[model samples]
Target: MNPKLRRRAAGHGGTFSRQDAVESGYTVSQVRERLRDGRWILLRRGFYAERSDSTDRPPWERETEAHRLAVHAAARALAGSAVVISHQSAVVLHGLPSWGLDLDLVHVTRTDRGHGRILAGTSHHVGELPASAVTSAEGLPATTVARAIIETSCAARYEAAVVLCDSGLRSGLVTRTDLTEMLGQMSGWPGTGTPLAAVAFADERSESVGETRLRVLLDTHGLPAPDLQVPFGTGPNEVVARVDFFFREYQVVVEFDGMLKYRDDAVGAVVREKHREDRLRSAGVLVVRVTWDDLDQPERVVHRIRQAFARAERAGMRRVHP
Candidate 1:
């Protein structure tokens, strides 16, 4: 690639437009030859992504990265237009978790008077994007994190909305107040209630998508709400352990083991977890571990938790302090 094209591609997540390539001293024929020779991967019409080795990453992560590249390409292509990346596309640009969101097409909202339309792989939404709601992510114009969360929540399902809202809150990129204010601006708009409900349901205490989903499961099953990130210790000024969810009434501690459950030393982590569980058991707290797979069996997981409550009662464990 020419120096100018390389710089442009690097700025836009390895993506470059045909015009960029041509201006960078590359002939149209050269661009076609590069694509034909596997040197350039076509992302969309008039756009291309430089192929790089991504074999070490998981398939889903690789796909998400590709979608991000496409988003950048779309942003660059529409630079002169009166639009900013919004909705799920904005969520991706903000580096938030986008669970259950449709990412096949890039999403953009027109700041001017334009009706919503789908052209090729781009979804153009017509909406009011105030100056406060607009921001730049990685040098590309997109919605602010708070506004993006509300837009995503409005466009996605409840669970997906909760996921985005939880992540947005946890990252400190957005606050509950920010979300509430954004929702206030969307009063009477279509699907505004969904985001309102999602914002109310969102908890920054949820540390992962799986944890957020698990919380939703408990609500869906009508299980008693558990305190989040509850701490336990034998003495004051020291916290021996912090659990994901704690049922004070039942003396049960539910630990969510998601992708970030164990970052290193798997064997040592398992041993340490076992020791921790033993300590909790000795302290009159029954442990119930939940995994990503366990979320798929919500009923079974709820049953197991209820059984733990019964076991705790049989053990005669009373209310304990941290």
Candidate 2:
């Protein structure tokens, strides 16, 4: 690779345009050869990402990094300065939690008047993007966290919207008050109600996307609301465990087991979690576990939890007052 091209690629988060490669003393053939030899990755037409050997990161994290790179490349390719990254694109840049979002398109908002358009995997949203609604992420112009969450929530499904809103609030990227204010500003707009509902349902205590999705699922199934991040076995100065979901009335605890928890030290984490459950069980607490696969079958998960609740009720398990 040309030295100048290498430096340019390094500066642009390991992604660069064909024009950049050519201007840095590389020919079109060279670029094609590098791509064919696994030295670079073709992100989209005219955009390329330098290949790296690191494979230790999770798939989601790697995909998010790629999305960030594509957003930057798209911003550089745009003709004018009116575009600011928005929606799920901005969410990736801001390091906010997201799931089931389209990663192929570079999403941007145009401050000028016009309809949003898609071209070459780039999505442009043209509307009133005031200065206050804009911010910088990774040195690229993008929407503020609160604005991004609102924009995403309006366009996303109920589960995805709740996850984004919950993540934004939990990460302190946006405050509850700021989200409410943003909703007020976007009042009467089409699809505003979805975002409003998502914000209302969002809780900052949701520590992961899975937890947020579970909360939505439980609500959708008409199950009673479970206290989030609830503590069990509390005394004057003692606390045995902090559970994911606690149903005091039913003496049941629901845990959304994300892969990250056991990704490292899987055996040890499982052993520790088993012991914790044993202690809870000894105290007459019914513990139920939900995994990613369980999330896919919402009905089954609901049924299992309901069964657990019924069993706890039949056993007359005494609730531990925290």
Candidate 3:
């Protein structure tokens, strides 16, 4: 086997040993040569990793290679030990925007919990991981894409998971043709794939789902819907400063937030959104932010919006009276 390819194949999240390379027919000298030339970087004492999985990838090129690296390395180190990547790492494999929910921890399980902690970017979560959830990716083990989706997709922007499901379907990662065959193969597995399927088929454009859900709640309550995709100023095409589901006659803007919106990095994104709202407020737009809990309690959300509206109306009335 080609030493470089063997090293790449070792696993996405594992380290390579010298004995494994020699067994695959690469001399220690060859491995050392590659490392010296910077063709491969030493991940640890015995293992090496190539810098790029691909050359000159397009602008949209996903670091799928990086994901591949982590999974491959972990699996090789485990060597038929029956482990699955779970949590945020799995989310990255499933290609979803985790909405700030990522696995800083790498999960693996053995009847005896050792042989983890060799990989740098990995922290160990030792527990009862089933064999069925582990599947082959690039000849190494990884969490099943569906399983990862279930484990990690509970996010602030539900649409992030939805988009991942869509991409998986579009790329044939999951399919109708294999659904029946998987029933028996997946029988003992804990997840049955419904949530992943729901996210996969989520229609952002539909009247009842995704970001549109906010639009429906507003219309149901008789609020004027804001312009979707309205351009604020210009740099990119249709650049949006913030997202508002409703903007009534320049008096108010309604912002809808989901879970994860209140988490740490989201604070920066939220602040940028607030800045956008501030710019609008400077021009007399009153912004009211709504969240999932507010959506769950429409009375509260509606009452708040009504109050903003009333305040705007009172200001308008006062202007006339004055």
Candidate 4:
């Protein structure tokens, strides 16, 4: 890659237009050769990103990063246009988790044009983007975090929406007040109900996508609400441990065990977790652990919680510590 072109690409999220390559002294034939030799990746028509050596990354991570580059390329392509990056594309730009959101096409909303069209892997939306909702992500024009979450919630699945909403709030990128204000602006708009519901259900206590999904799973199953990130202590100002979910009424603690957190030292992690659980149990709380796989088996998860409750009832054990 030419030094000038590389610098140009670096400024645009690692993407460059064909015209940029040409201006940097690469001929049309050379550009074709670069693509064929895997030196360049076509992000969109007339847009390319230098191929990255991401063999160490997992497939999902690589795919998400690639989509981010595509978004940058799309932003450059639409430079000077009133179309701001919106929806899932904006989510990526905002560094929010996209979990199950679609990224097949770049989404942009036309703040100037009244009509929108889908073309060349881009979905143009027609809408009036207020100045407040407009912001920049990674130096590219995009919808604000609050706006992006609501916009995505309107079209994405409820679980996915909650994930985004939870993440936005947890990261302090958007607040509940911010979300409520956005909802107010979207009054009477089509597809507002879903965003409204997701905003209402979003909890900043959720620290990860898996935690948010587990929360939604529990609610969807009609189970009793569990206090999130509950702490157990032996005395004032002494925090012994914190569990993911705590059923105060049933004296049960539900912990979400995401495997990623244990990958570096599974045995040590498990031992440490066991000690934590033992301390919680000694404090008279029955513990029930759930994992990524357990979340998929909703019925089993519910059953496990219920069984813990039954055992607590049988033993007459209740929360005895502060």
Candidate 5:
């Protein structure tokens, strides 16, 4: 048990490789003894994680952290001159949002023409990756933000793709113009249309993945495009509230109420939100609330929104001048 190695593993989400142990003056039997004594946990064939007693973190957070360390370890093991991290792994490395991606596998792209293959726990993509499409992050070769988003969206589901694109745009990791140019460069390539559509639909004003996914659901269901982050007030300097989605034609506001909104001060949040809704209602604006669970049923969500829209339409000719 070298203290330096222990510190390194602690910094790396409690994960270390067999090579790390060996280089730190630990023998094979010593590693086995640590595992047997519950001082360490074997994460994979040659990787080990330090045992911890803390249970404050959620299981998913702990698991994802371990997976990230494994990916980095696999990258070090598969070191190659042409290997550049891409796709979901690149997204993780860049600290970008991704939905429904497999974090268990390390994804890399080779800057040469060859067939993509999965070896051990690493997936290698083979294609022509221009120099501009590659960059370095945290001492690892990885795709640039725009290129990473393009590659990721090409392989992700529509909802996932749109979420990633929106996140990239919102974070300023990639620009809409850059994504559009990347789409043009990827034209005629396999799986380009989906990313193209994602880029076209992406909006930086979307504050979270839930909002982006909700927008996608609305568009997919043929609902009229609602103005995002619409401010409600009688005058420019007297802004009363800014809403998630606003349909001026129907005088409706659709909000995606993510769990985080109430996770911290539930009572205070409820009071503030209730007052906001009341103010909007008093202004003759119908308010519709959606949650993550509601997103699971797109049809039902759209139906409820449509009902709200109809109610607003039939409730006389009152309007709130924004």
Candidate 6:
């Protein structure tokens, strides 16, 4: 194996372009051969990704893989192309809720004639991006954190925008100047104004769609909000367990279990979660578990929550979704 190819293959997650492999000693023919033999998965015309057990992942995982491919292909979209994933696509990639489509197939591009976009599920826009607003995802350069914020944000995106700006910038993924500029540049788009509620949830720290959906439902049902990441003790505010939703006044916690909870190493996280649930249960707290399928029948979610609320009422414990 070419040292370059070998090194590129070493990473758990990354992408490759023809130029990289060419520099590594493999001709385009060899790259094509490697792909045909299942050693690689062609992400785009000149880009390749290794095929492994990771390729056997769920469809959504594959969708993300395809998205990475699209981002990789952006460099080849046209001569001097500067395409980057943006809009709902970046929001999903950023793992934030833009408009709550359980699954989304949208990305944005910076180019002329940005229109009824197709292929790669892309959307186009006319704009100039500061070099700083573009960052690479898994070796595929993408719109910068600020540009992504502008692309992904709508009225509903204020909270996500806040987090993307605050956390992303603070973490060194982006800069305040770019974020502010992007926000300003996109001021005229419909629903560009941020929402106060979204701003409030900026630091919510939700880790999954299930959690976000659960929080939305709770908020919609008018429940008093739960403290998202709580500290078990005061010394340094370490989180022994961070719950999906918890009503501290009633000693109740709820979590959602998607299929990910049943897989290999993930099952261990489930087991640990169950052990924590047991501890909370033994301590007289109520623990509730919900799953994606449960989300399909929201009444079920409402019923369980209502039952729990009734129990809390019986115990004279108060703190509802209001």
Write down the lDDT of every candidate, Cα atoms only: 0.87, 0.85, 0.54, 0.89, 0.81, 0.60
How accurate locally is residue 16 in candidate 3, as Cα lDDT from 0 to 100? 57
Error of 2 at 126 (Å): 1.3
Better of 3 and 5 by lDDT: 5
**In model 2, what lDDT does residue 201 have?**
92
In what order do the candidates fall by lDDT, top score first? 4, 1, 2, 5, 6, 3
Instruction: Note each model's CA RMSD in angstroms.
Output: 2.7, 2.5, 11.0, 2.5, 3.2, 5.6
* Least accurate 10 contiguous residues by lDDT in model 1: 258-267
Evaluated at residue 90, the lDDT of candidate 6 is 62
Report the poorest 10 consecutive residues by lDDT, candidate 5: 54-63
Backbone clashes in model 5, listed as residue pairs? none
What would the TM-scores of all predictions be? 0.90, 0.91, 0.44, 0.91, 0.87, 0.68
**Local accuracy of candidate 5 as per-residue lDDT tens digits, 1-322:** 5798988776554568888998888999998999999988766678887776646654545665655666666666666646888888888778776565667777888776666898878888887788888897656788988888888778778888898889999998889999988877777778888899888888999998889989999999999899999888755477668899998788889989987678679999999999888877776678999998899999999999999877876776435566
Best by lDDT: 4
For candidate 4, write residues 35-93 as lDDT tens digits: 99999999998999999898866565687898999889888778888789999899999
Badly placed stretches (over 4 Å) of model 3 are 1-16, 23-30, 53-55, 58-62, 80-82, 91-120, 126-134, 155-159, 169-201, 204-322
State the lDDT of candidate 3 residue by residue for 144-204, as single tens digits: 7655554444432444445444444545566533333443344445444544354534433
Consecutive 10-residue window with the lowest summed lDDT within model 3: 201-210
**lDDT of candidate 6 over 1-322, digit per residue (tens):** 5667768644423566678788889888887798889887766566677665664576666665556555444445443654666664565456433333222344556644355455544455556666666666544456665566655556344434454444554355555555556667766767666622343454436556566666666766677687674434223544355566777876667777777766778758878877887765655557788887787777778789778877977987765456
